[model samples]
Target: MFALMQSTRTQSLHLTVDAATGLKAVIAIHSDRVGPALGGCRYLAYPDDESAMIDAIRLAQGMSYKAALAGLPLGGGKAVIIRNPHVENRAALFEAFGRFIESLEGRYITAIDSGTSTVDMDCIALSTQHVTSTTAAGDPSPHTAMGVFAGIRATSMARLGSDNLEGLRVAVQGLGNVGYALAEQLHAAGAELLVSDYDSGRVQLAMEQFGAHPVASEALISTPCDIFAPCGLGSILNCQSVNQLRCAAVAGSANNQLTNLQAADQLEARGILYAPDYIINSGGLIYVALKHRGEDLGTITAHLARIPLRLTEVFAHAQAEKRSPARVAESLAERLVYQKGV
Candidate 1:
């Protein structure tokens, strides 16, 4: 564990267990150089404690890169609450988790992520002030979708020589809050949509509402399209999956899309313009960070407008260096967060 921390340059790792509430959580603080660690809390079942710790560590590191690349005055951390399927009281469980957060004081501020909701945030707020995405704070999904939409346009401009989405085919691989919202925007822009999800209801809804063609989840990666948006889980793009892709570009709101750094090189070799996940999917973090600092909606929107410009810069640098955008983004983020070139 210490070796992992040293390798990733993570600052610290914390854990807490409340037997009564069945709360078992791990928090990984990747860095606090720029500011306090800010990230989301994920509540999902894991195979083991080691898996949970690794997830938290990788996600915490991504959050740090996300914040640094977005030019936010915040560091990165992440929390994973190993789900207790048999727990009777959900609120009590989250509240106990909140107390664990409070114990860290202000070092970590958590919001909503996968398997978590605003209600959970409210419950967490009951014990600690270091929480966001409460009902009052509003959902960050739309903002995240908005940023991704802009990023897709920017990516289109870089790869296709045009920012227009009309008449283009886009395969979206998730139907969660962010993915569904992005599909709505893409439909509004007259983009042809091919959508897949584990939930039949969400896929049916997309078909009925957005005229999206339904594709099997397993086959979506191989589906030919102008853009492949992975708005779901991480590590979707691995060695075999990369070879299966038939898209011109990859962009979405997923965190850590590449299974490893070498995956970026593979995408580049295959002539796929890869939008680094952390850089393109930072809309929610921006919304949460600015809102926490009391910024208005106008201010937040203005900040979001920078996503495309930053991505354009990354693309230009990648083109100049003859490297993948993922590598360029990682190098740039490391320089900012670590205060030295990697």
Candidate 2:
């Protein structure tokens, strides 16, 4: 697995296998200079182990950037279990996976993401106390949507000259847990929603509940709207799709949305404002990280309130310098990483 990350300077990449449970897991730690590593457990079928290793590395790196920007004393790490939970001995597998985390001795902590859930966290908790986003905190999806809402409003303020989402046409791609919550919030704010998802059931629900118009998945980026919210996978916004985006801004819960720094440049040159993915999507990580610190609900709420403020700062700086907000956010996060890690 480490061979997959060949030239990249990864801190650690640990894989565990249990033949009895058919468990093949990979844990990647990107950095711990700022604090202990905290991320999520992802359970999904990969084309191969190399793909899973690459996914873990990218997610862990994103978590580090996300943690720094969110002002959390945490580094970046991620664990990926490559298995079809539907067919495997799930309970025994999750328990064994939890022991892997336990063996890390708190150097790496995890919550939930993608195919993993709170019940999986409970199973992991049986072996280690390093799991979070469970119990009182519940799912972090809503908080993540809230933070993205803050970012979208910030983008509107900077680019559209208004922060009010009322009547704003926003196209949200992907209708997963976080995407549904975001679509709901956008509707509540009176924004006309254009929603798309691979799951047709979710699309029908969004249309019925939020009055969202449906767009085909492939046509999402070209839809005319005030904002384009990519709430699904990462690396979708590349040089090609960047120009295809018809919105005035981009903000969503998807991590690593940009294909590279050049994607940011493409958006900027096209006069589109982009709220950095890591900065906007850090809300989930923030919730879990705060929960790990045993913070109360009120404290977590207060801390989350900073998400918008940070975005506003990034927006203002971007406008002042006429630079991509992505670059500005990256510099800010790196400063935090270096400072806090010190």
Candidate 3:
């Protein structure tokens, strides 16, 4: 299984910096099923070279599934810029990234991801027209959250037999862009919210903007809520944290939620409804795919509305066959891609 998983890490196009600073940039294009691969370029200070490579490879692989499940005519690709943006040569780094994208010549389209933002994407757009900057309309976080909000409703209906979130208590871990947007939707639905973040400022914003109940970072998972939303980072829903969760369902935007397939099975045995990350957090991919193809927002919104239906199907399959939701989601995505000969 490890070998198969690692096989997903295709060789990336690498470019090394020639500055006094040693920086590495990688563009990993996982697949091109529906169309050309599309993903965000992230700039961060990885602890080591291997870590950055693994993140780029894994994220790109996830994008392939994300676009496939979202029914988009695009594949998956990701770019990673080595060096902590806070301390790096911003102009040189971004220019190098832009030149790198230019080198691809439309094979791989770059956008914003975890560490990359609209402002940063603007820098990328300067040197390469291949960069996508839908950020002008505003952050995609709220739209993503809206999609997740819709998904929760769909999941609740299919799994918990609830159609409304009027009285639902949701614990959102990581009050970032998508997290804050999700909080807004929950508040609008009259759902009580508990939010947490590594940044105190974001936590305070969640509290001030939505009147959220803030919790310590360590307590976010076991807050005894209807939904445990891990919006911050990946691998939080592993074996240890799964045992600590007090929520009825696990759903959020973070990628690679399960550390491994065994943890996904563990969540199933515990009867905790697990919405696969690749399936539920597909809104961003959908938006980018549309922008890449020059499609309008109405078309994008219509496509986004199908997420809940997809979730319903995945949940039913999991329950009926006694399989993990992640596996079911992956199987369905692979079947679609395989049928298309992609």
Prediction 3 global C-alpha lDDT: 0.80
Looking at model 3, residue 206 earns an lDDT score of: 77
- Per-residue CA lDDT of candidate 2, range 273-300, in tens? 8998888887888888887788888998
Task: List model 3 lDDT by residue over 30-53, tens digit each.
Answer: 776457778888777789877877
The lDDT, on a scale of 0 to 1, for candidate 2 is 0.87
Model 3 Cα displacement at 342 (Å)?
Answer: 2.9
Clash counts for the predictions, in order: 0, 0, 0
Evaluation by TM-score, superior candidate among 1 and 2: 1
Winner by lDDT: 1
TM-score of 3: 0.93
TM-scores, each model vs. reference: 0.98, 0.95, 0.93
lDDT of each: 0.94, 0.87, 0.80
Looking at model 3, which ten-residue stretch has the lowest summed lDDT? 9-18
Sorted on TM-score, best first, the list reads 1, 2, 3
Candidates 2 and 3 compared: the better one by TM-score is 2
